[model samples]
Target: CELSSNASVSPGNFILHPSCDYDGLIPSVVFFLSFLLGVPGNIAVIIFRPNFQHLSSVSQKLMLNLVVSDLLCLLTLPLWIYAFLYMWTFGLVACKLLTFFVYCSTYGSGLTVTVLSVQRYLLVVHQKNWTHQMGVRLLLVLLWLFSIILSIPQLVFRQVTTLQNKTLCQSQYSSQAQRITVLLVEGLVGFTIFFLVVFSYTRLQKKVKQAAFFNNPQTTRLVTCIITSVFIFWVPYHFFDVLSAAAIFLNNEDLLQFCLTALYTVKALHAVNSCLNPLLYAFTSHNLCCKKSLSPKI
Candidate 1:
């Protein structure tokens, strides 16, 4: 609760320094909105099975996996939103578990998107069907396994401590090196996925441009919009994360403060991105939209 000039933040210690005030009015609202839209949107896709016809069955399965991960992020929003607006009344165990699941789910979603894009590219451009029915399951297993591995740091470091009589849930770093190391690891993994998605789509676009018989159902607009939202919404989250690492490495308190503050905006953007795809797919799918056109008056 109290900030001291020389605080020891070692494990089992309770005096961890708080990051800047990330929980503000605007970010809290954004978290609430993301929860409102994302929960229903993802659930709709699951119940209705909105299909993107251009994607192969393999890609569709990957998408289903993605929806689960998105739901994980959305489901945790209420806890985070409440903590922002009020306080993290949940105990340290809850804080650790919640943050761990969040890190896992966010990483899982990013990896899923990257894999989906790459699978699409390979199917479209190179005609490479590397994974069939059985392989996909194994891929999913490995994906989550990696996600859990990466999320362990969050579980280990995330703690619940009070600030000004209001409980806060945040990661605690014992040393400057520890903070930088964690952020760098997270940033590298995230941006690596981002670059993979970009590369996959870039190749897809190039190959499509050169193909003479590229006249399919034209899912280009739909797919492009999804990828665009990923970059538009998720890229800043990772960018600022990396910048925060840099700021810490350089010991620039002002820069570190600025990057941490900017995270509030990018977090909102990322939450919106989580829900955007469902609206895109649920509304855009021709088969799904036209299915009920012939219904008699109920």
Candidate 2:
């Protein structure tokens, strides 16, 4: 896919490439904001309070994992911003490794959220804990394993490709079928996580309103924001993937073009998602994450 810009390219004029203006500027700014806000917030969550790593509560542990994942996603923003304004000067290995980190962080975030929701459902509605810390620890370990395995394709396929005389970091699949398969898999997995979260939250709604821990208005608001933010920020990013896969499958060039042009914008929205978690889970969840009476224990 080619980067679209406002400046018209005359015939055989490959030097006039896309700049930081037009399509590039928006995502770069979004990435910058996400980094500026997300890094400090996540760091505060980890170190602001005492014994952060020694958290025993299942929710707290999962929330920490989520914070770490967002930080992983946020840390890559400087490299991305530079790539957007100039080029990917970090070479082939950096492209693969950096992109791999992004994939792992994203999958880890979604999976952590899924498991956290399930843990809450059991506690609030079923009156059951995870039984032992070992179980939760093992479960988190498995999630990371799965995330890395799923991200292998990125490590294998992403490269620094010179497009329109600009060195850009992008994925290059062997065929349309390969590209479609990867896109479909990522979209399906994301939706499955989304569906599970929705299901758990739906089950918790009535119970939570009556439950002691969820009685705190701040707790209730935090839960609602957590659920709503996932949909608002991530749905479109995945939606574009599904549509892009369909466009390639149908050989619809126009639809593929539209998807390509708009996909970066959706990715910026996804970045915005990572930045807001600090506010939702850390700053605003003083009642839920910090309070002994409100935060349910394992």
> Which candidate gets the maximum lDDT versus the true structure?
2
Task: For candidate 1, write residues 162-273 as lDDT tens digits.
Answer: 5666576777678878877777777788778878888887787666556545432355665577668777766776777678778777878777667655564456665676
State the lDDT of candidate 2 residue by residue for 207-256, as single tens digits.
65665544457666767787898887667667777987888889887787
- True lDDT of residue 30, candidate 1: 78
Q: What is the lDDT of candidate 1?
A: 0.67
Candidate number of the best TM-score: 2
Residue pairs that clash (backbone atoms under 3 angstroms), model 2: none
Q: How many residue pairs clash in each candidate?
A: 0, 0
